[model samples]
Target: MSHRRPLPRGLRLTVTDEGPGFPPEFLPRAVDRFARAEASRTSEGAGLGLAFVQAVALAHGGTAHAENTEHGGAVTLDLPC
Candidate 1:
């Protein structure tokens, strides 16, 4: 991970990583409670992390999204204050 500077107005924050990317359809349900892109039989965690993130965004009038990165993949949350 890289050190993050305070966001600048009109500039978007991007988070990227090298990891297995989720399917396109997964985005629609990424915030669903207990919905795990990787089945519990294979993946770790109870799958609440993303849901929690989405909740925080909605609560703050922001937004969250997931997309395939050119090299790896990433999930991005944009909050306007």
Candidate 2:
């Protein structure tokens, strides 16, 4: 599911998925370059997805966040209009 809210100067968008979610310890580093969750080490990619997202957000003067939910995970991006 997803939710979006208007901000004073931008918007707050959140997306949630039904999965195992992210590891508590890995949440903080999820946006780091080359960082990957232990469970997905052998999956694919160089783990730059979140890093790239964060970079884009920063470029737009916004921010990105990731966290584990009770059923899965959530990623939020706050961006300016």
Candidate 2 lDDT over residue span 1-81, tens digit each:
999999999999988999999888999999899888895466778889889989999999999989987879998999999
Q: lDDT per model, in order?
A: 0.67, 0.91
TM-score of each: 0.72, 0.87
TM-score, structure 2 vs. true: 0.87
Clashes of each: 0, 0
Q: Please name the candidate that would achieve the greatest lDDT relative to the true structure.
A: 2
Q: Which candidate is the best by TM-score?
A: 2
What RMSD value applies to candidate 2?
1.6
**Candidate 1: segments with Cα more than 4 A from true spot:** 1-12
List, residue by residue over 1-81, the lDDT tens digit for candidate 1.
Answer: 322334554223456677767767777887778877757457577878778877977787777666776665666766675
Off by over 4 Å in 2: none
